[model samples]
Target: MESTDLMKKINSFALRSFRDNADRDYIHARMAYRAQLYPQCFWSSLHALEKYAKCILILTRTERVRIKKNNFDDVGHEVLKSLKMLESSLNIILSQQTIDFLKRLENGARFRYLEVSWHSESAELTILDRAVWELRRYCNSGLYSYENSPEVKLLDNVKELLQDIENVTVENTHIAGGRLEAILKQPKSPARKELVWKNLYFSNSKRKTVWLESNFMAENSSLFLYPEIIDELTKYTRIPKEIVNAYKNG
Candidate 1:
């Protein structure tokens, strides 16, 4: 139960991991993956909790969209609003003290992460099987290539642990470019990027400053989003009849 012992166990689990088995870079990447999986605890140990939340909120959306530059538009408006709500909600839950404790490491990986399980042996097997299932599906669908992609190494755990995995090829997948929701990544998107930059950034101000109190100019406000809410509410929430039967039979 000692920290040293727990780390040793995690390392042992990694050594036996499918990812590490594939290659060394994979080994390192897998470590990062594990940390991200439980960032609630891992992030706090490395960087300040407040910074990590900002990083996660930013990076997650960025990765989702894979934006080289920025994209701002009417579609981006909703995303900005959602971010404000999400940020406020997170801060409200974590509190200032806990946020400080959690956010000690935002720059790089240089601290401890919470272990998945006490027994490295079991943890290895579990992690491996999940990787296999996830990657094989991507591979079968033609969304990934093993020879060139880090995705193959990521699935190392699955290849070792899965007993009877159905081989999935790239042809079997429907997702292209990683995932469906890819447009939300750019700083050009509505909310803070443009609003903050144009309104908040002034001749006297500097960049990277998150200024809250300013002569911020919001768009001419009316019943802007209220109509969309009404539109969604009027739409039927019922599932299709065929899918309903499939679920019932299962």
Candidate 2:
């Protein structure tokens, strides 16, 4: 096969793996929320959204030219920054409310280490639902053919999860217990029932295997060995020999 065809296959495989990983995080986030583990939920939600944003970048842009700033690392963990960077290129606009939630989620991510106390409104999960729903809608819009890819059940299950939670009140750290427990004990919708069942299935070896395989490739492949080289080449027609030499020696 030609190099272009090879890259396309590699990219397609990578994209599906990425989407699966993102769904893994998303599933765990929902589980955390249902269990009233707000902090874990926030962290997982942050990762899920960041990966979703990156997936959009991969889908729309070339591997070497995705984002120009900070060697395509400027978006980093900032969901809003990633969305803003994609706005012009993808012509996708997020509602101000979703944008605000992303900013809040960025701040919430810092609460991971318990260095500071933070208070988030109970409706934050609802906002997260909207953000993920929007991104997934775009992702499944057939930007590329996925006829050969294995079905990611979480993709379909999450749509119903989002719908079920659309009106249900999701509590936050500041206002925990009582109603939260009551909500969890309530009769589960068919969607929630399936979510609970499939969550366990998706959480099994299949999820870990896909992520580990993707990570193994990323770590072992020379293609990702020197992102700095990609950065220099992105900025200039030719890479400075010194930069190449430094990587060669370092």
Candidate 3:
């Protein structure tokens, strides 16, 4: 019921969802490419890259800003926007060629729907390949940073403790002749409550909704993390600690 508990639940769900979506989009992109669905492949790859970029943003606690009034769609599908966010927030420099490719593939209107003249298949494939490679590198590096982070270790510790408790509870239930009611009635530990609370809190946060939205074409005006989570994420993020701290305190 406490705010901290609610935030823990939300963080868990958000992290899990981010991980799943990143992998799913990347796999879909690969599948589309292998099937010779060039247009679909281009668009899917862009989506995967965008999702991965957003994950980096969240991990580094980057705050999104609205540059234009009532232009949510512009912010959401703009690959350039994501790149710029990474650059400005985490100092992740993207090469100009990479920027150009992403800008071309920013929205699916020109490629996905066949709105533009068809290009040579080989040329398009080359472009797509390069984009995928660069984006994959960025994503993998971000994930590596996350994996080595202290916050991840803390979260893992919480998960292990929860698992241990569950294991003991199950054993007790078995010892008591599988009395389901007694096991179900056992008091939840503070750690358990905290984890559940975070999941629930984050589930309701805008960060989760924005990232999970299926309409990749739609623009999202803002992207941000819950401040409390941001505070903790800042501690172990690759972004400059001063910048993160300033964002948190500002």
Candidate 4:
């Protein structure tokens, strides 16, 4: 959901940057789809998770979610830019060096890594988790900069948002990079899982659906898919009555 709005903003930014691309429409559609699916197909897909996991940079903003570590010391965005560029061409077109570089960065889980801390990698996983969560939140909230303008105080917007975040002094809060790794290693929830299905998707109508039921067995990343969600999705496959009865009856 955050990515949906983010895709629009990113496209707007691209338009401003490129002025015009001959293949603007094609690129736009691809970028938008990836903006939504990259996290799912490439990153969230356990089968393919490792393929992009190393490229998944953990970013953090102390004042606000806008200031990338790169503008200061954060470089994760740069990695994302490069990887996205490579992803633009799915074929053997992006060059081997580019792929190699990304692979190296990903293997170390230190590639394109960015954050504000001049601290130790103590709570590496925990810090990584926070960084991912922050990026997700950033995608949801929005980022702003005065790069093209002046008289703007740096990190002021972040300060504004920080006023609202209920910063709790929870346990393991200061183990440095531990947070980030924790988030990175954690599994994504499946679309048809219990929390997702029961909380946001499921309804009496969902029961009669059949498409999801059919595909449930076909999904590659069923780990995120909750069994309860699968059961719920069986109800809403949109299949005809005979199948629905057999499904509900059986």
Q: How does each model score on TM-score?
A: 0.17, 0.53, 0.44, 0.22
lDDT comparison, 1 vs 3, better candidate: 3
lDDT of 2 by residue, 69-159 (tens): 4355556677777666665545454567777778878975643443234554555555566676556444432443334332112244334
| Clashes (candidate 3) | 15
Model 4 bad stretches (over 4 Å): 1-105, 108-129, 145-155, 160-250
Q: Output candidate 4 Cα RMSD.
A: 21.0
Q: Compared with the true structure, what per-residue lDDT tens digits does model 3 show for residues 18-93?
A: 5346445545654555455656766676776676566554544444443233233334645667656555334454
Tens-place lDDT per residue, model 1, 1-250, is: 2254553443344223412232222222234334434333233222222222232233222222423223322222122222343342222122233333222223223212211111111132123222322322312112212343211222344333322333333233222332111212334543223222322111123433232222212222111223233334336553334333433443
| Better by TM-score, candidate 4 or 1 | 4
lDDT per residue as tens, model 4, 9-97:
55344332321221122123223223432222222222222212222211111221333433433333133443343232211122344
- Give candidate 2 regions above 4 Å deviation: 1-4, 62-66, 69-74, 144-250
* Pairwise lDDT winner, candidates 2 and 3: 2
lDDT accuracy of residue 165 in candidate 4? 29
Off by over 4 Å in 3: 1-15, 65-74, 107-112, 120-130, 136-250
Candidate 2 vs candidate 4, TM-score winner? 2
